[model samples]
Target: MTETKTIQKTFWQKYSTLMISLVVLVIYGWALTGLTFSGIQESAGEVSSSIFHGLTHPDWAYVYDGSGEDLVSLILQTLAIAFLGTVISAVLSVPFAFWAARGKNEGKLHPRSTTGKFMLVLIRTFPEIVLAIMFIKAVGPGSFAGVLAVSIHSIGMLGKLFSEALENMDHGADEAIYAAGGTATDVLTLATIPTIMPEFLSYTLYRFEIAVRSASILGMVGAGGIGTPLLFAIQTRSWDRVGIILLGIIIMVTAIDWLSGMLRKKLV
Candidate 1:
């Protein structure tokens, strides 16, 4: 009888969190019931079949026809866009990162850090596609617009990452420099930068991987890359061309990821 009583007493302790989880699941199920899915498109079958057939039999000749619009040229352009955008964002993110990062003496709930986080949240929440469209209007729809969109969109994430790195970084080097009567610039260059540059470069390379994919998508909006021609091929029902473009993108992205992973391992 005493064992039974003890089990009863411990029941809530063992299952209270589980009961809360069940309640959340029920709430999610209720919310999902309100969603109404539309019927599939009538042409979806034919389109899917064509896409698959195209994939199996890609236009090999499109790989290089000496046309400036070939896959090789556009892939290079995409890489260039991602590289430039990532570099620009990395440089511009420094001030924002410093501003957002909490100082060593600051409390967890400091107003400055709170405001900076909120601002970064706003920036991160804005859609890159919308930014691309807005920039397209200003820049007349080209690779430059793509670059601008990526640069601005990337700052939100990069700043957050950089600030987090700063906040968690070891203070030993900084303290040592100060103890040695180092000037502010001396501390910054000799202690801070050397200590943090590797982290910054690692994050930048990861962001570059994401930027490459984004650059390709931006090309769909006439931002200038392989995606522009890929879209055209799709619209014209040129599945073979689509196949070749997809193949090129796959190869290019894979190569970049491999190279970046190697570089990051060294830098970090």
Candidate 2:
């Protein structure tokens, strides 16, 4: 009886978590089914043809946009928003990350405590589109709004990753610095930053890739990017134009992904 009980316990320990996860997934799938479009079957044939045709025959003329400002230029705008946003977030996240990182101290006001965690969570709760809309109201619809939206969203992400990197840094040097009467700023500047710089760079590059995609989507909301024109092309049934814009997005994202991946491998 004892042996049988032990076997049963082990089996349950191994499979109970999986069973719960399966149950949760089933429930979510059922909910999603209810939310799915009921008319998809009716529209799928026509939609498929339109999409297929558009993708196959993109307008090369729109690819360069005649005089100079074209799909490429708009894509460059998207890249600029993402680049600036990532830089801004990377710079701003440092202090928040240090505050959020777990350290030697403990208790409510201790440096080791997660006092900044709540703030980070709050910031991340709002999606980039929502933030873009808000910023559009504040700054008007343009690249500025897109930049602000991406920057704010990037901050939450960078801060979380940065804090994790800080928490996992070599404590020996930091302890020595503290013991030698070094200030928090000194330790961070000299020890913490150096130790985590590689990981920080890797995360920043990854975030920039995501920001590029996000910048394009934010453009759909009038935040300023190729998305506005892409939307217009779609609404006007200009599939040729849509194809050009999509191709531009695909090329830009692919190139950035490749470069960032290479850099990350070298750094990390």
Highest TM-score, which number? 1
- What's the TM for model 2? 0.87
> Which segments of candidate 1 are over 4 A away from where they belong?
1-9, 16-21, 35-43
| Candidate that would win on lDDT | 1
Q: If scored against the real structure, what TM-score would every candidate get?
A: 0.90, 0.87
lDDT of 2 by residue, 187-259 (tens): 8789877889999999999999999999989988999988999999999988888988999999999999999
lDDT of each: 0.90, 0.89
In the range 19-96, model 1's lDDT, one tens digit per residue, is 999999999999999999899999999999999999879999888878878888899999999999999999998998
Alpha carbon lDDT at 106, candidate 2? 51
